[model samples]
Each structure stands twice: as C-alpha cells, then as structure tokens.
Target: MKQGLEPAARFAADLAAVWPEDERSGSLGLAVSGGPDSLALLLLAHAAMPGRIAVASIDHGLRPEAAGEVALVERVSGERGIPFTPITVKVAPGNVQARAREARYAALAQWARAQGLGAVATAHHADDQAETLLMRLNRGSGLAGLAGVRSRSTIEDSETILLRPLLGWRRVELAEVVAAAGITPAYDPSNANADFDRVRIRQALAEADWLDPVQLAASAANLAEGWQALSWYAELDWHEMVMRDPDAHGGLGFTYCANVPRVIAIETLLRIIGELGGHATRGEAARAWERLWAGENASLGGVLAVPSVERVEKVGVAMRVWRFRPEPPRSAGH
Candidate 1:
C-alpha cells in the first residue's frame, strides 16, 4: 500500500487476467537491465508481489559499462531482499543486436530453470511495440509479422515463458514510476544511436505530432487477433484436409487434397516442414503453393512439394494429391 505502488498493483491486476493465479504463486523471474523501463518493472513488481520475485541482469560484454549496470540492478534487488543473479553472455559473430538478444534470453531461461521459476517478465512498453510495428511495416511484413512483439511468448526452444506485463504502459509512464520510487536508473548510450534501425524509428515517432503510442499498440493488438483467427482456421483445415503419408521412406511427410484452399495448403506445408526439422519462410511457402497449383514440383528450405495421383479404392477415381517431403541432404562437395 505504498503511495507510488498503485501503478504496479494495476499492472499486477492486468497480469492476473492473463496468467493463472496458481502460476503467479511461485517465484517469478524479472529481467532487470537497470534502464528506466526495467528498473520501473523491478520496483513495480516488487510492490505488487512481495517475496515472490527474483531478478537477473544480463551483461552482453559488448560495452564496458554493462557490468556497472548489472551491479546497479544487483544492489537494487539486494536492498529489497530479492535474490539477484548476474549473467554474462558471449555474442556470436553475426548481427550484434539479434545475437545479443538470443544470448540474453538463453541465459535468462537457463537461470530461471535453475532457480525453479515459472516465467520471466520483461519491460517492453507501448513505445517498444509501436517501434516494432513501424519497423516491420517498413520491411513489408505480412499480417503475422505486423502483429509485432507478443505480450507472451515461449523463449525459443525453452519451456520458460516470457511475459511482458508493461506493454500496456508507455515509456514516459515508466519514467514517472521510477521518479516516484525515488530511484536512479542507469541509461544505455546505444539507445540514441542512429545506426540502429529501432533507434531511428523511435526518434521519428517522437517527432511526429499525429502518431500515438497507445493507438499504434492497439493496431498491433488488432492485427494479432487477425493473425490468431487465421491460425485457428489453418489448424482446422490441417485437421480436415491433410493427412500423413505413411508410405514415405526418407522422412516424415504429409499430403493434402489438391482442392484445398491456397492459404490452408501453405499453412499445412509450413507445419509439415517445421515438424520435419526444416523451416519455410512465408514467401517460400507461397511460391511452393503456386508451384503445386501449376502441377509443378518445387523445393526450397529443405522441403519438397510435388503433385501426384492417388487411386481411390471402390470409387474408381484418381484424385490429385499434393505430396510434401523433406529433401535429402547434399554431399559436402556439392
């Protein structure tokens, strides 16, 4: 019942609506980076759910200041009697931002598993969602991509779920929460760097008079609903119109009737490819569908689709079937 803890309580209620009450009964992992947003989350989560939270800060080792930031978060967590763990991750040699993100989540997931925590929460706010939407739109993303960052997602291949409870709050609101808590948060210099696409988009959105973060986030939520509806129907179609090809020898595969809708066909193919240890991008799936419709064989991303005829017993009819299979691996020299 602290004076500045109202926002945290409000967010706690918001999280409760999404998460089961039993799930929140256990200790939750909070990803605190000591930035204004994460720091605010640390304070708010502490106020809302006392004695049920542990904190961790990831040091990507990209900058010298990262260690100090982790130290700051550790101190804050210690002062509140919360368990604190600091993790250092080595970034791989590609796409610094993306690699760092992957490493960060991996480390967090590992730490959370060790601690027996159920879910890890981050401080992605409305502005972050807006920036993500704008970036995906600029890249010509489809409906699923345009849905932007989800509020809850499984961390890669890990069972640990990621929760973003602050997506409904704005950046400025988080700053206000930090100020009200009388805590000084560390700032990362790279947030203002124009070399990063997200930073540039954030700057542009700041200068625009008509654009609002809340509205942009709402649009993303609407698109997420649309994406969900598509997925629902896709799964329905998968169950109704597709079946496993039991006679396949090389790898597991599926077959669908030629009369299936294009969207359903593409979704079913993508699901099959995913199940067979391969991935097909949206464009690849669409092109494969076009090839199947034209009665041509197509192969991409280690999956192959070809047209075949199946004889129906007792019906005396040869029905067209689109057979999908995983491609055989190439030799080293090839």
Candidate 2:
C-alpha cells in the first residue's frame, strides 16, 4: 500500500504544480487514447483524484481499430468508477496527423464546455518533448517552435484549459506503470510507421544512448520561459512603438526609435504579421527588419514593408518609420 501511495502522491504533486487544488474541485477531463502513456495517466489520475475526474477517448475514425481502443478506455474508466465519454471526430483533409490533432482538441474543448469540466489533461511526456524539439531543430525552427509543448494552456481559442502533468514522466516509466497494473495498452500502427517524422526521430533518439531525453526536455522548458519573458517585453514595445496606419489598405506602422533592440523589433514584427492575418517565420521577420533598417523595402507573407523618415513638428525631429500593409493584388498581365 505504501508503495502504491508513493507514486500517486508524486503524481498529485506534479498535478498541483500545473492545476491547483482549488482548480481541481470540479471534474477534470482526461484524454485517454488507450496508449501506454495515456493509460498510465488514466491510472495516475484515478489514483490521485478518484471521483473528481472523467475520461475521454477521442476516436479519429482513421482506422478501424480506433473503436476497440475507445472501448478499452471505457472499460478501464468504468472499472475505476470514473465517467467516460467516447467522442468521434471527423479529421479534416490535408496532413492526416496535423488535422487529426486539430480535430481532437476541438472535440475535447466542445465536450469539456458541455460537461462543465474544470480542465482537460493529456499525456504528453518528456520523451515526446525531446522528439518535438529535435524535429523542430531539424527544420531550423526558432525559439517558439523549439519551446515544445506547454504544460498548461487554453485549448485552441477556447476558455477550457488544457494540462499535461506527465511532462516529467519518461516513456519507459509510463510503460512500466501500465504493465505493473496488468493492463495491455493498444498500440497505434502509425507509431511504428517510419514515414512519420516523429517515429524516425524517436528511432534515432533510441540509438543515441548517450543523449538524455529528460535533460533535453528541461532545456525546452527553459526556452519556453525565455520565450514568454521576451514576449512580455515585446508587448510593451508593440504598445509603445507601433500604431495602426490610417491607410485604406489597413496597415500597421512601427516607429523605429533609436533605442529599439533587434530582438524586440523581431518579436513585434511577428506580432504584426499575426495581427494582419499573415504568418511570418522568425527568420523572415528579422530579415524584414534588417532590410527596412538599411533603407530598403521588403515583402513577406503577402505584406509589404517600406521604410521612411518622417518629420514630426511636436517632437521637432525626423523619426525613422516602417510601414507594413497588405500587398496590392498584382495585375493579370504582369
């Protein structure tokens, strides 16, 4: 009994760090896909909170085995006396994994809202984080991409908060936990498919025995904190140095004050791209700023960037200014 209590107590501590006790008073939703990681999460959640949790098995309908997997989760949750919800979602076209993920969260958000649950928890673990970091690094992703998965955040644009208390747990540890409970986890065929980038990365990480996934996950978490701090400062810069342009093209203008740091400018320009319904990579934003600073015009993600110097009578000086607006539609002949 003491041995069982120890793991539960530790899991509870991890949960409290992300989802406070006061926040867990209401029912918490658990995403259980019948995989070993999520099954361990289910067992841990049941052990920690007992009656205050519900289980959700999302069936993407991509494979026939998904139904059996959902049924397994339902049976396990029923054995523990926890409420279970089986949600079937339609995966949108294009990028099967990405669309499936989007649909999964959307369904979970809708279910949680209707159920009035306090928060939803998933089973993203440390190994998953390391894989994500490596994948992003391979693609030359910037800070935001390398930050990996956040422990706690809102689901998409919804108010329902999502939690990942198992970020500190390792894949083998989770598999052991489930095995010790005498439960067989359903294996997803896609996990073994080498066509997926994550599967390939996981295989590579397995071969490199010297690399530590826990340390890599810790680095990703540290990067996440640094990104958040930079973002806060960027907001201040945005408010101080950025203004909405009155041009009919619906543009944004930034005053390139003498003291503006390159980091702040890059972050703020990324914000401008998001606000204008365009997506700009961090490298693209930095290059745009560099060109504008050199008195050259640049275009990025369907937005035109032009730099100029403007005289202001109130300030009694000329200030460097960068204007960003939607690029005009090109003529058909051209």
Candidate 3:
C-alpha cells in the first residue's frame, strides 16, 4: 500500500496546494478519461481527500467504442462508491482533436458549475507537460507558449478551477500504480496517429535509450521552473500595461494591446488568431509584431496598423485600424 500510494500522495499534494481554498460546500470535480492517469487520480484522490470529491468523464464520441469506455468508467466509479457523471461531445471538423479537447473541458466546466464544484482536477502528468513545451517550441511560440499548460487555473467566467495533480509524476510511475491496483487502463488511440505532431514526438522519444520516463520528467520539471519565472514577469506586465478589446478590428485589435511586455502581446495575439479563424503560431505573432513595430504590418481586414496612417506624422500618435481580408480563395470554376 505504501508503494502504491507513493505517486498518489505526490499528486494529491500538488492538488491540495493549488486548491487550498475551500468552497461553501467543499466539493471537487474529477475529469476521468478511464486511463491509468485518471483512474489513478480517482484512487489517489479518494485516499488523499476522501469526502469532497466526485467524478465526471467526457466522451468525445469519435472512437467506435467510446460509449463502452464510458460504461467502463461508470462501472469503476460505482465500484469505488464515487458519484459519476458522463458528458458526451460532438466534435467539429477541421482540427478535430483540439476542438474535441476544448469541448470536453467546456462540458466539464458546465457540469462542475451545476454541481457547485469548487475545482476540477485532471491527470496531466509531466510527460504531457514536456510534449506541450516541445510542440510550442516547434511552432515558434514565445515564452508563454514555452510555459506550457498550467497546473492550476480557472476557466474564464466560471467558478470551477482546473487542478492538474499529476504534473510532477511520470508515465512510468503511473503505469506502476495501475499494475499495483490490478486495473486495466484504456489507451487513447489518437495518441498514436502519425499525422499528429505530438504523436511524432512520442514515437521519437520511444526509440531513444536516454528517453527514459524519469529523465523526461526531470527535464520537464526544469522547464516548468523556468516557465514559472517567465510567467510571473508576464502577468505583472499584462495587468499593468496591456489593453484589449475583443471586437476591435474583428479581433486583430489584440495587436494594439502590445504596449507592455512581449509576453502579453503574444497571448493576446493567440486569442486574436483564434477569433480571426486562423491558427497563430509564436512565429506568426513575432511576424505580425515586427511589422506593427516597424510601421509595415499589413493594414487590411479591419486590422489596425499601430501608431499612425502617415509614416512621417507623429508616428506613435495616430492609431489606424482597417478591415482587410486577404483576397478570397478562387471558386472551383474560376
């Protein structure tokens, strides 16, 4: 029991630290994927804080056996005497996985709000943290992108907080926990698709002798420390200097919010790119930002060119915003 409880104790400590504040009723929501990662979380959470927790699973309905998987989760929850709720999601086309993830969290948030849950916990381990950092690096993300997924946060306009309990644990440790508990863990098939960037990373890591889970977990911890310092500085600047208008220039106005540190600028730009129906990478933010600073950022599609219209006239005094979309794609007949 001590060995089995090792990883669980560490994870539970992380959760309790991030979620120290108690709610009126002291209820917590658990996001279960039916994998060892989350199953372990359920078991550990039970051991760590016995009375205040409940479970919820989001079924993205993409896989053929997804509903069966949900049933398995319910069975496990029932066996453990935990209350469970399953939310089914219909994923949209184009970037299906990302959309599915967003919908899953949104559903969880709604469900938690309804249940009067104070915080929602997930089993995002250290390996996932490293992968996200690498992905953001490959995408030319800036510091905030490099900072990776947060361990604790709240969804916008919601009372429920997100707590990642296993951010310090490795996948190897989790596998051991599952084995010790005599549980069968479900693997997410989407994790192996070669077409996805993250899967490519996983495959590359698998072939390396030095890519042991422990080493990867250590490296991720280092990255997280660096990211924490960078994020602290960024938050200071964001609150003090940046101004944002969601509707400005069809959301390209997020560019004008770049008055403070470059970190806030990039985060705001990330939000803007999503609003503009385009995926903006860190490189993309740098590209757009360079133009904005030099007075040559393209000024089309209700997007503003910061400073002024006339290059010579008090450059920083006049702010110019225009609505310009790149020429529409040609029709099939054309």
Model 3: ten consecutive residues of lowest lDDT: 318-327
Model 1 Cα lDDT, one tens digit per residue, 50-94? 898999999999999999999999999999999999999999999
TM per model?
Answer: 0.90, 0.90, 0.75
| Cα-lDDT of candidate 3 | 0.68
- lDDT for 173 in candidate 1 is 89
Put down candidate 3 lDDT per residue, 107-127, tens digits, no spaces: 888998888887888888878
Candidate 1: how many backbone clashes?
0
Q: What C-alpha lDDT, on a 0 to 100 scale, does residue 333 get in candidate 2?
A: 96
Off by over 4 Å in 1: 1-5, 248-251, 258-261, 308-320, 328-334
Write out the backbone clash pairs for model 2.
Answer: none
TM-score of candidate 3 against the unseen true structure: 0.75
C-alpha positional error of residue 235 in candidate 1 after TM-score superposition, expressed in Å? 2.3
Task: Extract clashing residue pairs from model 3.
Answer: 300-324, 301-323, 301-324, 302-322, 302-323, 302-324, 303-322, 307-318
Task: Write the candidate numbers in order of decreasing lDDT.
Answer: 2, 1, 3
Best by the TM-score measure? 1
